[model samples]
Target: MPVDIPGPASSVSVQHEPFDVGAEIAAIAAGRPAIGAVASFVGLVRELPGCPGGLSAMTLEHYPGMTDKALEDIVGQARGRWQLQDVRVIHRVGRLAPGDAIVLVVVAAAHRGEAFAACEFIMDYLKTRAPFWKKEETRDGGHWVDARDADDAAAARWDV
Candidate 1:
């Protein structure tokens, strides 16, 4: 059974298709007059170094239930920290080429501070905590990517 999340305050989806940032923003901002600020972050796939033949594509894989729960938990944490009006997270799976959109996080709040902080918080947690495995493809072949020190440091600042 699907869980019932009351109100239009939050949404999280994992799909293979691309999402329209403009449409997503409009949908979340609609009918919400109190929202004075909206902040968003879009992650894109780029060519990584050390690929002998250069990068061609990347594949993302995740377990259905686990991935959803992890994302929801991250969003819940962000909501607890900030007074947000709305939040949306969309993550793409399957094979994606260079320059493809990987993930989108949108946060709305009455103040720019809350919106910006919440947006970054959600992204930081998502990057480290989400259970997604990535394999980068090059002309030579594909290799499973590993977690980076920079990403860990980004998520560590939220520790209290």
Candidate 2:
């Protein structure tokens, strides 16, 4: 799918490489002179307490066509709501160890506020709407992560 923003130089990659915050920000801002500020967010796997089994790794699965469409829609919304120069989202799937990066979001805007807000909005929506399923691998076995009601509520806030 094509990126909605004009200044992004048309780059989007989804892979299992260890995510680097600095590299992602640089790629999103590359050759975009109008971008005065860039905002980025990275999500990582976390261990929870009181679980029956000890967490070891996480594996993510996503619907290809739907995932791409949802990301494109989120980016479009951010562009419409803010004067953003560019936006990019990269989400990794498959087995990931602890401290591994699961997702990265980057937003470029003329000002910091717009960039920050757009980045946040994309994350919020991704947490809820994106058709990505996660499997938590523990010492005992592996299980799919259930959808959280809290995530739904968070996305609902932007429904207007």
Candidate 3:
């Protein structure tokens, strides 16, 4: 019951296996010549900011139905606000080490403004609205990560 939505304009997937970012980007506008801009963002697991000796690894968990619905809602909102021609979202789960890819957002539009804004808007909402939980493995042991105020601020700026 993983969150994988297949559609002509929008695609979303939550998978444990790695994905090819390049191929994903290319597929968004494989045959469509109308797309003028393709904006994308890739999030990665990095060393925990406050960890003493740095993070060893991080694990992500999510409820299948809830996570998918939240992501779809975010994308739906973006589509309404912007003139996005295509959108793609991919999130990874389970054990992930620092430097590993965590999420990918791609948006295609007739102009750079719409594509860029839509990409960021979707990611911002996904950060705040998505049900994914994170746990970090540090020298002290595993600890459930807390929501960051910055993430809230990022999502809040959109005013969506």
Candidate 4:
């Protein structure tokens, strides 16, 4: 499901199509002279280490409305914490092959520090807070992916 946010400064989309990182970053920075820095992260599906036959593919699933709201809230939180100019988050759903892009997050601010910090913070929170389930497929079979302790720890450091 694609959600086009009402404002040009922010948007959250949960889609199956791959996104263009350059275009996304450019769109947010266009005509915005105040934006001095842009930070972005693009997540990709990779082979599972030590898994039999490696990872053939991965599937992501989410509840439409709920997922959008969760992502929007995350973007809002980032905006509240930093003096941001624009933010865009795109998370792909459905089947994805190895090396395929899974998610894209772009943040723009007047300074590099705020842009980088907010970008990292949003990703850390998204890892544990986003209401999405993932299934990894190998030649042997497929299994649901679970939350990781490292991810939780990453988010915890930013806690108030």
Task: Go through the candidates in order and give the C-alpha RMSD of each one to the true structure.
Answer: 3.1, 3.7, 1.8, 1.7
* Stretches > 4 Å off in candidate 2: 1-12
State which candidate has the highest lDDT. Answer: 4
Best by TM-score: 4
Point out the higher-scoring one by TM-score: 2 or 4. 4
Model 3 agreement with the true structure over 59-126: per-residue lDDT tens digits: 99998887777887889999999998888889999999999999999999999999999998998899
By summed lDDT, the worst window of 10 consecutive residues in model 3 runs over 1-10
lDDT of 4 by residue, 97-128 (tens): 99999999999999999999999999999998
| Model 3 spans with C-alpha error above 4 angstroms | 1-10
The TM-score of candidate 4 is 0.94
lDDT of 1 by residue, 56-144 (tens): 99999887788888999999999899999889998998899999999999999999999999999999899899888899888878889
lDDT of 2 at 88: 76
Clashing pairs in 2: none
Give TM per candidate.
0.92, 0.87, 0.92, 0.94
| Deviation (Å) of 101 in candidate 3 | 0.2
Please give the TM-score that candidate 2 achieves against the real structure.
0.87
What lDDT score is found at residue 83 in candidate 1?
Answer: 94
Between candidates 1 and 3, the TM-score winner:
3
